[model samples]
Target: MQRWLTYQKERFPLLAHFPLVLLTSWCVLSFASPEPVKIGTLLLVTLLILGLFFQLRVFDEFKDYEEDKTYRPYRAVPRGLITLRELRNVGLFVAGFQLTATYSWNYPSLTLLLVCWIYMVLMGKEFFNPEWLKKQPLLYMLSHLPIVALIQMYAASFVWDLDFPPATWVLALVSLSGGALLEYGRKIRPPEKEEHGVQTYSALWGIPRALMTWFLAGSFGVFALGFAGGGWWVLSVFYGLMFPYALISALRKSALWLKFVELFSAIWIVLMYLALARFP
Candidate 1:
């Protein structure tokens, strides 16, 4: 139990993820339907989103096992803090629970849920072309990032009829941009912190270029949120503040600021969704 707790702390901090997922699930449902979201339904959808995220984390653990063992031996699995078999069982259990719950709650959602699972499985296998994909970091990131949008679509299934009109898809676009922003934010490390085999945007594209990409992603997110009826002033201000901080941090090569950038990415997503929920 203690080991599992430590693993969750290191790999997936619940305190940070729960509210973000909850808000994400809520905003999707709220955006889909004008009616007030029921508490029970909101909680169920949040559970589903949380399970999907954890399942993906487990998939990453399995897929990256070798590289992690060789280049990142201090991680939970390589350090022997947890076994792959144990993580596999947990993943299976979560998958089963998600499948069962979705089937019981809304049979129509099951199809979309299965589709999301298929995409996730493909991601876990790196689309069976790990060599080619690894050589193309941009494509690799784009392929995996759509899962965030798919998860949002699945959440919308609870409130929407699944027709997924243009307006509905704009919400997915917001999610995709958020995923990109978070992906770039977390991977933009200082030069001193770059690992030999680890692939970071900073290492691949250099700091200035990586920061530009991150900024563009955040810009797209703001546009999508505005299109989806989100409040813009607050989001714009927050983005303006974070960009300079990111520049200063990258310039000084401050590891602490890089961590802040990651945390700010989460905050940005949460704020975007919150803005949608409020203005809707």
Candidate 2:
């Protein structure tokens, strides 16, 4: 049990995931209500989202098992620290916990949960055509990212009592863009560090192009946040200056700089949600 707990903490890093999960739920819930949400509602959504993310991680482990064995055998699962059976059991437990929590909400909210739950299952299987999406990275990413929007919408549904409004699309788009930015950032590794069978964005699209796409996604995130009437200006200027510098540094092929850029992209998402919670 201790070993499994350690593995989960190392993979998910609660320091980062908890803040982002809590704020993400708060940000979306705030979109439905001008004032603060109830403590019970806020915590329930946070737990559901966190469990969903954990399942996503478990899905990745199963999906990438063979690939990880070939490209990065030292990883926890690839190195035999834990088996897929164990991980799948954990994933099922988390999903059950999420369902139990959602049962406390209204029936309409359960429908919203079902939407996300179904979407997540499809994502885990890569829509039943892994090879097809592996050949189309952008489409693959776009397909997978809507879950972020769906989960955000699910959070909003609880606040609005099943009468969630279309205005919440702004929050959805913000979540999508922020997710895309982080997705792009992590997959943008330098060429030398790139391992065979690892389909990094840097390898798929040249380093410069990948960096440009990441920055573009971040810009869209800024626009979405500002459009949602949240504190977006701080992020706009922050990313506007930060991205170009990160791009230039990435061009110089500094691995350290690229990693820092990844960290910064995560912080950008965290801060945006924090600001939304505090000011929205």
Candidate 3:
């Protein structure tokens, strides 16, 4: 048992936990507001989503095996801590099991599960195709937007059964811009001399240029969130909280953007919950 726990920790890492926490909380909050659903049903959805979530990590290890060896040797697959066969087996088992459990939920729940699966597959492709899409930076960012929107939509409407409120849109936009910040930060990786396979933003374009593009994209995110209609103070507080992170990012010291955005994203979610409580 101890060995299995350690393996999962190595395979998924702490960063993996953030997405699961955000997603699961979104689902549970859905159950909480407007009207509460049966605890049993909510529990089932949580378990299923969380299960698939972990399994997706396993698949990432399998897909990025070589890249991990060269660039991210600490990662589970390249480090030889876990085998490709084991990853595939575990991913399939978890996905099948999670879907089977979620099948008992309403049709919308099952559909949401299916949508999540398709997203996992597509995201894997996106990571591999980053270079191909870099020609159109805006299009590249636009392509990734739906993934965030889907998560927000599932949490806001499908699970919560709440109307698409201004607050939910704020959350979705925050999630998108937060993610873009990561893409922007990737532009800062020191340039490599030799030809490389890694299709990162920095790899395709030199760090300075990438950072400029990313900052512009982030500016758009801030503007969108700022203009989005909602409670003035709540929105102000949310955007204000993000500014420090952006400020730190502008200093161009290191990859602090992710740290800031992660903090910002978490705070954004909390603000959303507060808005939900006060407004609805």
Best by lDDT: 1
Model 2 quality (TM-score) = 0.91
Q: Once superposed on the true structure, which residue ranges of model 3 sit more than 4 Å away at CA? A: 1-4, 14-28, 31-33, 36-42, 127-131, 134-141, 155-231, 252-261, 272-279
The better-scoring model by TM-score among 1 and 3 is 1
- In candidate 3, what are the lDDT values of residues 92-186, reduced to their tens digit? 88877766665544445566566767887777777567568756766866786666556545544445443445466556665576456655543
The estimated TM-scores of all candidates read: 0.94, 0.91, 0.67
Sorting all predicted structures by lDDT, with the top scorer first, yields: 1, 2, 3
The candidate that wins on TM-score is 1
Task: List ranges where model 1 is wrong by over 4 Å.
Answer: 227-229
lDDT of each: 0.85, 0.78, 0.56
- The TM-score of predicted model 3 comes to 0.67
RMSD of each: 1.7, 2.1, 5.0
What is the Cα-based lDDT of residue 202 in candidate 3?
Answer: 55
